[model samples]
Target: MDLRFDHLIHAVSDPERARHAFADRFGWHTVAGGEHPGFATYNALAYFGLPYIEWVGVRKPEVAAERPFGRDVLRVLRAGEGPMQFAVRTNDIVGMADRWSRAGLVHEGPIEASRVRPDGVTLRWRMLFPAQEPGKLLLPFVIEWPAPDEVRLADLRQSGLSPDPAAAPRLRAVHAVVGDLARLRRSMDAYFPGVLEPCESSEQGRGVRWTCGEVTVFVWEPAEGALRRVLDTVGERPFLAEFERTAGVRTRTAADAARRLEAAGAPVHGLWVVTSE
Candidate 1:
């Protein structure tokens, strides 16, 4: 199964607030995404071409806990906002389930789902969630869109859901904060298989890395500084993302939040544009 970085899901109490935070403070473009028809969530989208951010929010607290995705997000929102989960895309989601079975990983889905866009056009996809094991953190879910890559890219551009490819800065890597580095690597290795390696993130702490084309994922042990706070707050999650420095984005410009995260650790002002300061 060929897996690549897809959208990152940043769970929030309010989709609107998360959208404004990213656009007004972080200098990113976000658009309204429609609700999941049967799920207790809605979202706003920040499209960095194909690799995007989905700001998902709960619609009905009473119903949210009924689904696996909702239950996980609600579990983290109790600790306040953070990067709750991320996903990888593949052309074959069922094949992915087969891969997981062979690797001895438990999972759920390849279940069909769909949501209508704000423009009234309905979109559909399938998802496979790797069941988080006892005493271990969750891994990225696998998603498969019905359309081919080129066709989807064209649709995003023409429909204005995503900017032209070059108009957006590249997504460099995702910074994941985990409690046990060794355990997380074990899961990531089973999921990605034979691609994990060690990496040193100045802001996030020393951890392992695995790359899928242009996007890389770094799993870090929260340093004793500000990063430690993130661990205490959100438990194990991908707390931040780094992007290629673009016009509105800076290169470790010493912004207040950046300063604190810097003390915690990252590479060359690692978070670059992710902080609100």
Candidate 2:
């Protein structure tokens, strides 16, 4: 499996609020996000760069059904604020799982699902989850089949309702806060090997750094004030603003990136869209 970062999911309370936040404020365009019968909810994908942002909301009770993601997705729907979960991209998901299993990081299968676009295009793929709780700084996952390129990520980037010449953002890194930096780092070291660096922290929270190619990942638990500001900013709408922010600082080190986030006062919690140099 060519393991890598896929897209990040920022679960929101009102899918519409999520949509408008991206579309109206940031000028991101939405591709027809498919509907899930099981949850009676609908979602719209804001096709950014390669990884699109999905704004998901709960559906009416009558429409929702009992299914695998039903309860959990509903939980995200209710929670409201996001940076809910992050996704990993892997071309060979099955092989990656085998590697992970050998490394002792318990994991689940690449569950299969499909999303149909308005123009009759269907995206079919499989996904896996880390053997951990959902809320924790999410672990990496895999995506396989039909390759991400065949899906034309760049095409979707051009589909937004309006385009700002400055529309594209370079997502430099994504940071999450965790309780046990050493333990988590150990898990990543065992499974992911050389990718993560030694853990670090401040009065704010524990920090662990992971580097994927040019992208940097810093997992941090910030001070109360920072956390509250993050929640408040995302509670209204999340992904778009984030995607825009991170889109700028594409190839910087995690520490350099975090400093920018600190200056921005948003902290790298949810979706971040860094601007390109």
166-247: candidate 1 lDDT, tens digit per residue = 6566676676677788887777677767777776456535676667556777666756666676668557777667766442
- TM, every model: 0.84, 0.73
Best by TM-score: 1
lDDT of candidate 2 at residue 212, scale 0 to 100: 50
lDDT of 2 by residue, 67-95 (tens): 44445555555554566656767677777
lDDT of candidates 1 onward, in order: 0.70, 0.55
Backbone clashes in candidate 2 total 22
Off by over 4 Å in 1: 134-137, 200-205, 245-260, 263-272, 275-277
